[model samples]
Target chain A: MILDLIQNSFDGLAMGASYALLAVGFTLVFGVLRRVNLSYGPAIMFGCYAATWVSFSFHSNIFLLLGIAVLGSVLAGTYVERLCFAPHHKGSAIAAMVASFALWMQFEEVVTLVMPKHLYDFPPMFDAEPLAIGPLSLRAEALVMLACALAICFALHRMLYRSRFGLALRAVTDAPVAAQLAGINVPRVLLLVFLLASAIGGLAGWLIVSTHTQVTPMLGMWSTLKGLLAMMIGGLGSLPGAVIGGLALGVLEAHSQWFLGPQARDLIAYLLLFVLLAWRPRWMTTSHG
Target chain B: MTALLEVRDLVTAYGKIEALKGVNLDVQQGSITCLLGPNGAGKTTLMMTIAGILRPRIGSIRFAGEEIAGRPPHAIVAGGAALVPENRLVFPNMTVLDNLHAGAYQRKDDFASDIERLFTRFPRLKERSTQLAGTLSGGEQQMLAVARALMSRPKLLLMDEPSLGLAPLVVEEIFRIITQLHQDGVSIFLVEQNAHMALKVAQHFYLMEQGKVTFSGTPGALAEDEVIRRAYLGSARA
Candidate 1:
């Protein structure tokens, strides 16, 4: 029982790390713009799809595929920003979100049109067997995922706190008018942050798809749901909180799936969100930005 | 002396509701100019318009002989005018030092000495330089706001409601700093609700009513006008 708990904990945390990366990207955009990009997951899916298509037509290295995934997501993100977020910035936030959802449909259809297959195989990160500790086993890919998430979080923290651009970004996040008066170009900051978040989402998507060694149309909705869930669980618009929330969610889901079942896993995860919303609405609703 | 900041026939609006209707105002070099008005009189609107945060529908804003009517806020700040916005909107999450750094974001020069100078001017900000702006007390936040704007190295400083919410002693301290800044040759265009405090420091006063300049005079003239005194120093003053 003890060994099982330890093993489950490690697997849960590894899964949580991926969710944390997704959450971080979501939180960055939300933090600065104070708007949800509903197309976030779809954008990532678009990149993964681009790579999958590339793989079918040509034999490219996995690392090159990863680059294509990130680039494609960023390009999709730029589309969403220009067509949705930019014009609606000073306008209604609901309008922007609705427009983003509309584009989410566009992304889904575009991917489906090019690649009608419901599922496709992707190049995996490694063919190595799971690494074993004395009593527990861990996937090498999971370790990479965990390490990348932590490293990205640390780098982001440093960039935000240590660099001039970060200072201006935080200033813009704090109060946009004051930032403008202080001579920070508020619009440029918004665009840069959105692109940065999109790129991060793309990287997360590449990692997840490689781990599963499979791709599906559902990846868009799945990535979006998981990212949104983790962001809310951590606390809205907090970097560190998003990561913690992601991990907590992963552990909770892992334990529930282990003890109860798969359906119970999703149910308990959502139930926690519902309870959190009901008990402390502020945590879920407040935009820390 | 030449005007450091000038506004001629400025008309600004929110949709069709004209907030500042053909207003004419100017701040002389090295003078503390105060704008007094009731809640809906558009005092803040005029300040925002002048600062380039809000564009004027029709008129001219010439700062230091440059036409800056339609320019962006950062360009205005870059051209040597900084607005210490209303209610002390400091970057609450950032440290005081970071907030100061944000002020100099437009400048390419080294502002180490300027930061040191601001610390000397607002000692409380120095004591809490590493602390977040949100954690500071109301007065300290106000000082930080002032210091943050000063980081831009403006010749003309536009301050809106600096004494809006603060203790009596803190207000006095703010006024003292304003007086000292004027003596140091920075032109100040001030918006104040405190007529009594404003009358003390301001050499020139403009009274705004329903988005137009109703009265422009000395402190004595401001006090002597029956309509102006009753409206400005009436229920709102208390």
Candidate 2:
């Protein structure tokens, strides 16, 4: 029982790390643009499919696959910004959100038509062998996923807090008009934000496919919803909050599945979300400026 | 002195309501030009228009002999023009140091020495360089706003109501900084409500009412007019 509990917690942490990446992407875009990119789900889905295509046609090297996925995500992100977000950015937030939703549906339809298959098996790039440490058995891939996620998070934190681009981004985030007066190009910063968020979303998608060893069209919607929920729980627009929220969500889902059953996992997670929303509506408010 | 900035027949509006009607003004090189107007006289609008935050419906603004009427705000700053915006709208969430850095966002050269110079000018900002601008006092925020604009190394600095909503001591400090900047060879275009303070530093003055320049003269000319003096310089001074 003790060993099973340890193993479940470890599994939960690995899953949580992936969720954290997605949530960070969601929060970062929302923070800068002040609008939710509903197409983020489709963007992640596109990344997974792109990585799959590259792996099958050429090589199955993990680093190369991840690179392809990031590149795909960046492209998709730029497309959404140009087509769905930028023109309407100065308009109502609802308009941008609605446009993103439309793009999301378009992406879903495109994927359905192109792939035709309901599910595709992702090629394994990491050893699936379990590593035992002091009676707690953990998969090597899961460990690698956790390490990768944490490393990405660290890198993002440093980029935001320590770099010149980061300072410009934060300046834009704080007061866009003031940023303009200060000689910062607000539009360029906004585009950079969308690209960064999309790249992170792609990384999360790659991790999810690598761990589950499968890809599906449905994964896009699922990941987006989970990421949004995690962002809300962590406090929207707060980076540290998103991380904690994602980890908390993963742990909660794992414990729920273990205690109740696999079927109750999503149900319990949503219920917790509902409770959090009810208890702290103010906490969920986005405070960008 | 050659005009550093020349504005001719500038018209700006907000949804059919004209705020500036065929306005004409000029800022001479190395001199302080003040625009004095009552509330709703479109002072802020003129400053914003020059800063490229607002597009004039019809006008030509020549700066350093180059026409720059419809350029974007960043381009205007790159052309060596900067606005110390009204209400001291500093990046509230950013550190004082970061705010200073952002002021020089367009410059490719190293700005470390410029920051040090600003620190020497406003010593209080240097002490709280790492603190967020939002956490600073109103006086400090205003100082940061001025310091931030200075970081661009602008040849022409436009100031709009730098003394608004500040204590008497703070207001004095702001005017002192204005005088110091003018002495340092930076041409200034100033919009101010305080006509008494305007008389101290302004080499040329324009009075606007109902979106038109109603009066233009030196401080002596303004002082000689009883109606203008009482209306603008305050009852105590008049």
* Whole-model lDDT values for every prediction: 0.90, 0.87
Q: Cα deviation in Å at residue A142, candidate 2?
A: 1.7
Compute fnat per model.
Answer: 0.88, 0.85
Identify the candidate with maximal DockQ. 1
Candidate 2, position B12, lDDT: 94
Candidate 1 per-residue C-alpha lDDT over A1-289 given as tens digits, one digit per residue, 9 for 90 to 100: 9887888888899889989999999999988888999999999999999999898898658888999999999999999999999898678999999999999999999999999989999999999999888878899988998998989999999999898889878998888899999988888888999899989999999999999999998999998999999999988988888999899998899999999988899899999989887886665666474
Measured by TM-score, the strongest candidate is 1
lDDT of 2 by residue, A55-142 (tens): 7789888889889888988898899999888887567899888888898888788778878889888877576568778888888777
Residues B1-238, candidate 2: write the lDDT tens digits: 9999999999999989999999998999999999887778889999999999889999899999999999988999999999999999999998999999999888899999999999999999999999989999999999999999999999999999999889989999999999999999999998887778877789898888778887788887635365255335433421
